[model samples]
Target: MGEEMNKDVTIDTPYITLGQLLKEEAVVGTGGQAKWYLREHTVSVNSEPDDRRGRKLYDGDTVQVPEVGTFTIRSK
Candidate 1:
């Protein structure tokens, strides 16, 4: 498969949770799905494997989901 494109996710807050990011990006329908989503999908934060729904992502952080795409956190 081709390399995934990096998409920017702008946030006004200091940080956003993994669940919130997934919801905002429309990857999952509801925040409650984050738990199951994490279990079924692979998520990495800054290249490190992370499966926590509450993982705090700050500006400049990178989230990569192999089945989906890469997302970069940006502050607005």
Candidate 2:
């Protein structure tokens, strides 16, 4: 709804789905909720709103929003 706070999570891989990342990072309250957010919330890649939750998040891809916080794809 407002300016998204910067949040961080460590990813073990380069490619990950939004749904999986949500669960893995415990971002969404529930799996079903993640789906709903995917539809309602405007997820951004680098800065633009990205609706494709199924899109693979690779290196340097940043998912940001007011509720979900900021998730950066990292190497571990």
Candidate 3:
């Protein structure tokens, strides 16, 4: 299989929630989808399993989704 794509997301605030990031990145269609996605799949934050939809992702944090790709959080 080909390598997953890399995406950089910049937020104006200090941090963002996992669900927000997923929805913003279009990973999931809706908030409900983000919730369902988190429940059904394994999402890693900094290489650790992160199931919390509200998990705070600060600047420099890395979120890796096996199917989607990697998301790097940055402050704007």
Candidate 4:
């Protein structure tokens, strides 16, 4: 195998789950509560609180933060 690469994706229609964003992503913390808190606290698109960790992201939405980089939805 080789070093894993995170692909750059854009939303044309929209996706409803954070898990759907990653190929092998996992929540890191003490437990579900902690994970929930992390999800609640962090995770933003275009400087907006992505309340639903399972929110369907739409085009023009930008996922940002200390990590996770930025995900911009492009025309497909």
Model 2 lDDT per residue over 7-47, tens place:
55566776887777777777677767778877887777788
By descending lDDT, how would the candidates be arranged? Answer: 3, 1, 2, 4
lDDT of 3: 0.93
Identify the leading candidate in terms of lDDT. 3
Please write out the lDDT profile of model 4 over residues 1-76, one tens digit for every residue. Answer: 4443334565555453443543223333333443465455576667876645455555555655334456564546
Ten-residue stretch with the least lDDT total in model 1: 1-10
Residue lDDT tens for model 3, 1-76: 6789798899999899999999999889888898899999999999999999899999999999987899999998
Most accurate candidate by TM-score: 3
**Root-mean-square deviation per candidate:** 1.6, 2.7, 1.2, 5.9
The lDDT of model 4 is 0.50
- Would you list the C-alpha lDDT of every candidate in the order shown? 0.93, 0.74, 0.93, 0.50
Distance from true position, residue 67, model 1, in Å? 1.9
C-alpha displacement of 57 in model 4, angstroms?
0.9
For model 1, how does the per-residue alpha-carbon lDDT over 2-61 read when each residue is reduced to its tens digit?
776779999999999999999998889998898899998889999999999999999999
Q: Model 2 residue 25 lDDT?
A: 71
**Residues forming the 10-long window of minimal summed lDDT in candidate 3:** 1-10
Which 10 consecutive residues of model 4 have the lowest summed lDDT?
A: 22-31
Question: What ranking of all candidate models by TM-score puts the best one first?
Answer: 3, 1, 2, 4
Q: TM-score of each candidate?
A: 0.91, 0.72, 0.93, 0.51
**Candidate 2: where is the Cα deviation over 4 Å?**
1-5
